[model samples]
Target: MTETVLAEVLAELAELDDPKARAVNERHGDDHGVNLGKLRAVAKRLKTQQDLAVQLWQTDDTAARLLALLVCRPRAYDRGDLDLMLRQARAPKVHDWLVNYVVKKSPHAEELRRAWFADPDPVVASAGWALTTERVAKKAAGLDLVGLLDVIEAGMATAPDRLQWAMNHCLAQIGIEHPEHRTRAIAIGERLGVLRDYPTQPGCTSPFAPIWITEMVARQGAAVGRANASPGR
Candidate 1:
């Protein structure tokens, strides 16, 4: 039954593949060509199935694994399971979706975060920073926000593209959420000049920390203004 199910799912994924879609994904370092929207739709239809998810993940097909991430019971995997999955998922999209969709919701997130944070591998370390970025925007208690900024300032400019982007995200989140750290965050961004010249589509915000910080803060302030101006009171 498991073999049959896996075969069926793989067939369905193959049916969804598009040459143009693959071209676009290839540019981003993801080899699979299945449209993401269709993949999500399939997952929605299949719903959560831990056994099936594990089988899909074992196949190591990028599209299958992405679907597995969507259908899996996130908290079911133990620490070691997630660790293996992260290491095996080297494709950019696979790596990103695994981290964002599955690992982030797993019970071992904090444990894995600490382990991955200082891993010699920049790709692994980027996952750690991604976890930290979530904390910066959400919980943030017990975090040495200053220390995070210090590390980012020291390394982000020299970090690999993926790791640098993750670090930049954390920096922007800290500036946007914490009033006290805003100045240093902006200053660090300005000094390093990382992502400073990154091209952005018109009407989209640049990922450069200083500009990102300013824009996000302004948006939040504007939100507050509109909320206060509402007639609820």
Candidate 2:
């Protein structure tokens, strides 16, 4: 029964593939060609199927794993299982979705964050930083903002592209959300000059840390102002 279900899902994914989509995804380091909307539609139809999700993930097909992530219970996997799956997920989209959709909700997220943040693999380390960024924004109770900035300043320039992007994002989050660290974060970004020249589509915010921080802070301030101005408190 499982084999048949897996085969049917594979057939569905194969049918969704498009050469044009593959070409576009290739530029972003994702090998799968299935339209994300179509894949999600399939996942919606499948709903929660941890068994089927595991089977799909085991196939090591990018599209299949994406669908698996969409349908699986995020808390079902143990720490080791999530770690192994993350290591196997080399494609950018798969890695991003797994971290954002599954690991973020997992009970083992902080444990994995501690382990993966220091992992030698740049890609895995990037996931660690990604988790740390979430903490920086939401649950920054004891995190050393200065220490994080220190690491980002020292290594981000030379880190691999993906890891550097993660660190850069953390920096921007700190500056955007914490008034005390905003000046130092902007300074680090200005001095490093990483992603300063990154190409951004028209009307999209630049990923360059200083600009991102400023734009987000401005938007936040605007939001606060609007709330304060709202009638009848």
Overall lDDT per candidate, in order of appearance: 0.94, 0.96
Model 2 TM-score on a 0 to 1 scale? 0.99
Q: Write the residue-wise lDDT of candidate 1 on 31-138 in tens digits.
A: 899999999999999999899999999887899999999999999999999998888989988899889998899889999999999999999999999999998989
lDDT of 2 by residue, 85-195 (tens): 999999999999999999999999999999999999999999999999999999999999999999999999999999999999999999998999999999999999999
Worst 10 residues of 1 by lDDT: 224-233
TM-score of each: 0.98, 0.99
**Model 2 regions more than 4 Å off:** none
The model with the greatest lDDT is 2
Mind sharing the TM-score for model 1? 0.98
Q: Which prediction has the highest TM-score against the true structure?
A: 2
The lDDT of model 1 is 0.94
